[model samples]
Target: MNARQGAATSVHVASPPEFHAVTGRSFAAGTPTKSSQKSDDRLTTARLWQVRADPA
Candidate 1:
């Protein structure tokens, strides 16, 4: 399926963070999959990025 289609699919949204690695550590850790890891990596290259980014 395509991006939009994939996003609307139950598999994507219903995917538990604990079961899927893509959403598990990656999503929980603010990191994406290995393929998309680079995109999010820039969100925080430093270890303190989260401290500065996420106020929660």
Candidate 2:
């Protein structure tokens, strides 16, 4: 699929708050694909360098 033909998706970030260790989180979204999912998953594996939180 050269052009996002299928599984089109979108994410809504109402308020991206600053990441705090106690309430820290990451925001990553994309099409339902292995690589895309993996990229998002990486940010949550052990919390590396997330600076903003999603409002969802």
Best by TM-score: 1
Error of model 2, residue 21, in angstroms: 28
- As a whole number from 0 to 100, the lDDT of residue 8 in candidate 2 is 30
lDDT of 1 by residue, 1-56 (tens): 67765455445435667555434333213334354555457655564676778867
| Candidate 2 segments whose C-alpha is farther than 4 A from its true place | 1-8, 11-31, 36-44, 47-56
RMSD, every candidate, angstroms = 7.8, 12.3
**Candidate 2 local lDDT, 1-56, one digit each (tens):** 53443323222233333222212233445312234455467656535344334333
Q: List the residue pairs that clash in candidate 1.
A: none
Whole-structure CA lDDT of model 2 = 0.37
Total colliding residue pairs, candidate 2: 0
Model 2 clashing residue pairs (backbone): none
